[model samples]
Target chain A: MKTRDLGSAAALAILGLLAAGLAGCAPGFDHLEIKIDTLPPLAVSVDPTNVELPVGIAVGITATPFDTSGDKMDSDVVLNLVPKNQKVLAVETSLDDRSFVLFGVGPGTTSISVQVDHESRTDIPATVKLQPME
Target chain B: MIRKLLLLLPAAGLLVLTGCPVTDASTGELSNGRFAYLCVDSSDPTCDGIVGKAVIPDLLAVGGAFDLEYAGDSGAGLVQVQPASDVMISSTAGTFAFRIPGIAAMLAKNNGGVVADFVHLRGVDVDHLDVLGESLAESIKTLEMTTGVAAALAVSPRDRLDARLGGALAYTWASSDPSIVAVNMASARNSVILAGIAAGTATVEVSLRSGLKMAVLVTVKQGVPMTTSSSSGAGGSSSSGSGSGSGSGTTTTGAGGAGGGK
Candidate 1:
């Protein structure tokens, strides 16, 4: 009887341990997720496409900014004249508007590019002819 | 039971630990937005480095655009002028002719000398002919021929011209339209030069003749000082456990008892 009791007690203890282990495993899985929204597309278009101005004269240029979502982006748009050596001659900013006018450029043919937050968004090569005062 | 409890303790602790959310170091609220700082060292003769520092601002507002022109010791080359409208000039040996109507012929005549030699008009207004000259024609002609609508002509003093010409022949253009406004070349230069040098404390004047009416000043300084600094943090938690048990007693005693009974 004593031996049977000891065996039963040992079995009970083992059962209890198994029950505890099973209880620990009962909780359902938890999932946490993080996601970022897509950024809006930015587009730029220049009017007149080409410009010619005599040296010492100021040429006014207009740059238009557009976003894919039709929602106006508050980002500032900058117009820069990039020379062959990649040196930036002039940088002008337009705020919350579709167009900007840049004045007083020196003589030279260079690429005009637009940057949004320092990111090159669009580039168009342009020729500038500066005629000496006759 | 106690052993089972002990086995479960680690699992329970783990559940508690896992229940807490992990904090991402990179996900903290930003204290500020970014900024670009440029410091040019013009004071130190040996140090010509331009230090650019990017800093995060305390809060993100709509960013602004900036255009900064630095005028240094490198002088801008020459004076330039731009005409507001088209101008036409006809030059004859001793006389200058302008296409503008109603101007007298006397206003067109100048002692056969280069226009550059007389009347060094830097930034004269085309509308102002009285001070510039009588011949609106001459003004128009100069404007048409020059990149700038304005021309700078230096008129030698009569005494000087008399001495220089030695009375061989001398002529001057007179304008019938005395009401025309003329821009003061000297004043214009002063204004432009001041505008160019406004950025630096050092009074180095740089003048460059960029175009007709375009003058640029490039300024270089010896030294400018600059400084910068940055910091960041992250954290996580986990727990786990397992347990097992078995028991048996007295097989030898039972075998001996069975032998005795047999």
Candidate 2:
């Protein structure tokens, strides 16, 4: 009977130890509150924000988008050219072409603006002059 | 009526305990019903803390699409933060510690605080709500500019400086040789136009409000670029970024840029 009693006590002690070990194994750092890290508002860069052409000239415009965290975002950048006077300045008129060729269509000064995002934009003013036949 | 009332009470209690409209208490703004969130305990917070977020409309766990594992000791050991994976595990008690890279990572703007860009899903387990894979480190670290841009870019005499940064940076743009190259604007968050105004070598200085500065060389020519396309140096060092000029436009190699990144 004494041996039986001792065996039961040993079993209970082992169970208690197991319980304690399990409790200590609970995940740490689960209670302290932490907030999410954010990425800064994206910045759009239009290289050569302005351009000058003397008719029959084409220039390449590259728009780079910068994130404060430095994540590359070239895939998200959009470029559009809106010529104040289509006759004075002519672009490929595609959303992807950052380059525009100046055609002395009428020899007038017109402004070309490129839309970056939904609301942010930049412009380039072009003055076209009629060149004499070479 | 008592039996019916009892059934509804438990369900209602569960709902209240895990309800919608989770807030970031630190910012005191709604977390837009995110499944995970950071409970900013104090009014003032800094780069020391922050977590990630998810796009869930409520804080409840999903049925079975999760694959969260412990950061270490996979077998029944205490789970610390595993910064590598986007998922973070936390308990109902919510005492968790995660690592943020530095101050700059925390200051990035997003869902309106310092904890919105780390995680994408909630991985709750072991009776603990995997709070948002919440946030960054406790110091301001320097940024290294990497690929996509260069210290020196080459283009046609009339071309513009169109370049992308390897990382995000806010800078004030200025042209040392405006006649050769001029800024598209006085200041831009990330854009600089080194207009090849003339056939010359010029410098474009990009400075941050914190006084971090970088100088890029701009060379414009009508024919093959006059400058060599050798790399200047890596981030944290100022070297003339090299550009290989071809007939039409310019292409940047692995050399120079003004932001820290891969």
How accurate locally is residue A47 in candidate 1, as Cα lDDT from 0 to 100?
A: 41
Candidate 2 residue-wise lDDT at B202: 59
Q: Tens digits of per-residue lDDT for model 1 on B10-59?
A: 99999999886432111101111111221121111011112222121111
RMSD of each: 44.9, 32.0
Q: Candidate 2's residue-wise lDDT over B1-262, tens digit each?
A: 9999998999999999989554422221112111233322210011011223322212212111211122111121332211221112222232332111111001111222111112222111112111111022211112222222322221100001211111112346676755334455412233333334334465666554445455555565423323444443231112122332231122222111221111
Q: Give the per-residue lDDT of model 2 (tens digit) for A20-67.
A: 999676432211111112222222112334444433222323344443
Give the CA lDDT, 0 to 100, for residue B132 in model 2: 10
Cα deviation of B162 in candidate 1 (Å)?
22
**What local distance difference test score does each model get?**
0.25, 0.33
Would you give me the overall lDDT of model 2? 0.33
